[model samples]
Target: MFESLGFEPDWFGLLGREVLRERRAALIAEACAWSVGLSDRPHHLRLRGRLVATGSTIGDRAATGQALSGEEDGRLELGDARPGSFQDALNAVDADGAVFADRFDREVIEPFVHETCVLAADRARRTRPGQWAELLDDLGEDGAELGDVVRAGEWEQPLRTDAEHLVLAALGTAPLLEVEAEGLPLSLVRAAEATARAAAAPRPEPEPEDLSGALFLALAAVREAGLPAPVPADDAPRLLAALAEQGLEPDEVAAVLPHLDLAPGTADRVAALLAAA
Candidate 1:
């Protein structure tokens, strides 16, 4: 999946493992006496009275035997079901109801999104800075002489706006090609032109589904939850409303919501809206 999306497979796998670990931890912490165990089945949750088995599917005969023998004590068992994909696991937990869904997003999805963005930024940092000579060479006429003048810093006039564009392209920075046209060496024009061409050359954009949107969602939830969050408190309601418009119920929203030291049970209130949904 990561390869298909142009991500480093090893990085994706590392992130995936981290997400699974976090998900398990959060579920265990919140389970309240439920025994969580790992299972190989896709759907591992089996709730019998208070005994919740999250691992391998118990055969009917075994379940009956356990029930008859009084071994079906009240406990929650978590299983390690190998989900087909990260998204599949997320959806499974979501469908399990508000509590599991919320925990999954908070413990797994949000962190995964954060790490994905970090990776993307790291990759972007490795992009080679454009060269000035390379820009000059792209200019057909007077390219070489202009390259020399640019190197010597003895150019006269400011490059034309179009030439300036080239400089911006090559350096991935604003052009400083402006000079007194009369005193400017002709070479600067070609330099600027080359820079613009380099800048305009196609470069890969981050994938549309690179978890940025998920990160934004997590941050917005935090902002809405209150101050000490990375975003302003005033932006919370707007962000929450936007998220609501995306078909997330208050409970689902609250599951991934971050909170400040302020208002308590904010998540409960949000989750309460699940009924209205």
Candidate 2:
């Protein structure tokens, strides 16, 4: 039970076991329906694990969609329904990890599927006389151990493995993300769509870029936003010595050049250099 969901205690004992399961199923539906529209991953995962534990299936398609964000074209955000203010307060913005994940999925996950399929067909031709097969005939026929054909990184392997299973089930009863129609692993769809999104996103054009200058400005913002941290006593003397070696005198709030000269910008520059380092 997510306390953050804010369900009334009066309703808790009022609902029977069946009703509770239904409630969990509904939350799972809402989460899956919203998918990436709900931007809280840790909470989402927690809620999802709970929901799945309650004997409700999100289904293969919905589960796959949850593994990655779906089409943003028609997504309606869950404003107020799922509070994002807490995560917003973290004040951190870094998409490099996501970008790298996308690349790894695209470059690694997709290839494993293709190579595995081709080599499996070749192996079937060589050893087991069979009708034409795409993914290993053993995939459908028996629970055979996977050969060391596709070398997938651990980061993307679980998703790729799930996607491979989905590919095997693509033509069967339930609907899917149409990834198999193009003969691709379901997992690769996430990477492909992400690539498309990245392409469509507006990018900042490089102009008269001063990376160090930007770092300096960013350092100022960090200092303002952050709690005052103690500078290490041991390191301060070393930094002063370094500054002296370059023929400048260092102080806590100010610095001097030899023969009565004040270096007004030196502190900020030194801070920026530390940040750059």
Candidate 3:
């Protein structure tokens, strides 16, 4: 008997036959309950004419029942009355009416409904470009105007991409004129007009250099002394040559020559010529 049952006779005598049978049944029941719970849908298992395990499926597949047996050593087996894999059970659960309704609303219903409304507006704009005022009249006396809607400041980003701006511009809506100006293609006449306006604008004159008090006094003294003004055309070369011999750079000469009261055009011409050298 012991050899056939795969246990030593001495062990059976120590545990007693009834105790061993009860323990084995308990182990089988525990294993069965765990294995049944692994099913994707609710499942039941029985062992030794008694209900042992029952549970609903979780995650993707039913938990592996054979592994749940632990050290039971193949003494137990699972029986499936539902006749399907764990995946099939999950599909049935998802197909339940309440679950399907909730999922459909979240995944498919809301987005397309919003898109359809926007597309309808776009279609209305395209088909009835000149009749926007007539359409607005249907809104009754208290309804919001197109100008009010454009100035609301809340729809700027959305209107940035919307095709409706072009329609509003075509309808001669004043509020959208700036948007129309920015978005409209630049014609050759408009481009030339912009360039001419820019060119005609008055330019600010350059700021005068700040002269030292001693430099001002020296200039005043020269004027008072009635010294003859040097002829820039005759004196510029000699002055530049003397400065160059003293190792003065062209930039240094340019800086110094500006302080001297030269003829109206001579200072600029001398600076430009020497700086190039």
* Model 1 steric clash total: 29
Candidate with maximal lDDT: 3
The per-model lDDT (C-alpha) reads 0.35, 0.33, 0.37
* Model 1, position 187: C-alpha lDDT score: 39
Among these predictions, the greatest TM-score belongs to: 3
Q: Give the candidate order by descending lDDT.
A: 3, 1, 2
Better candidate by lDDT, 1 or 3: 3
lDDT comparing candidate 2 with the true structure: 0.33
Which ranges in model 3 have alpha carbons more than 4 Å from their true place? 1-152, 158-232, 245-247, 251-259, 264-277
TM-score of each model, in listed order: 0.18, 0.18, 0.19
Higher-TM-score candidate among 2 and 3? 3
* Deviating ranges (above 4 Å) for candidate 2: 1-98, 133-277
Q: In candidate 1, what are the lDDT values of residues 182-230, reduced to their tens digit? A: 2134335545787999999999887643444554665565555443534
User: Is candidate 2 or 3 superior in lDDT?
Assistant: 3
> For candidate 3, lDDT tens digit of each residue in 149-253?
223323223332231222222321221123223333433344578799999999989886454543444455435544347526545555555556555556555
When summed lDDT is taken over every stretch of 10 residues in candidate 1, the lowest stretch is: 172-181
Model 1 stretches with alpha carbons more than 4 Å out = 1-99, 128-277
Clashes of each: 29, 0, 5
Record all residue pairs in model 3 with backbone atoms less than 3 Å apart, i.e. clashing. Answer: 33-53, 38-62, 38-63, 39-57, 40-57
Q: Give the Å shift of residue 45 in candidate 3.
A: 47
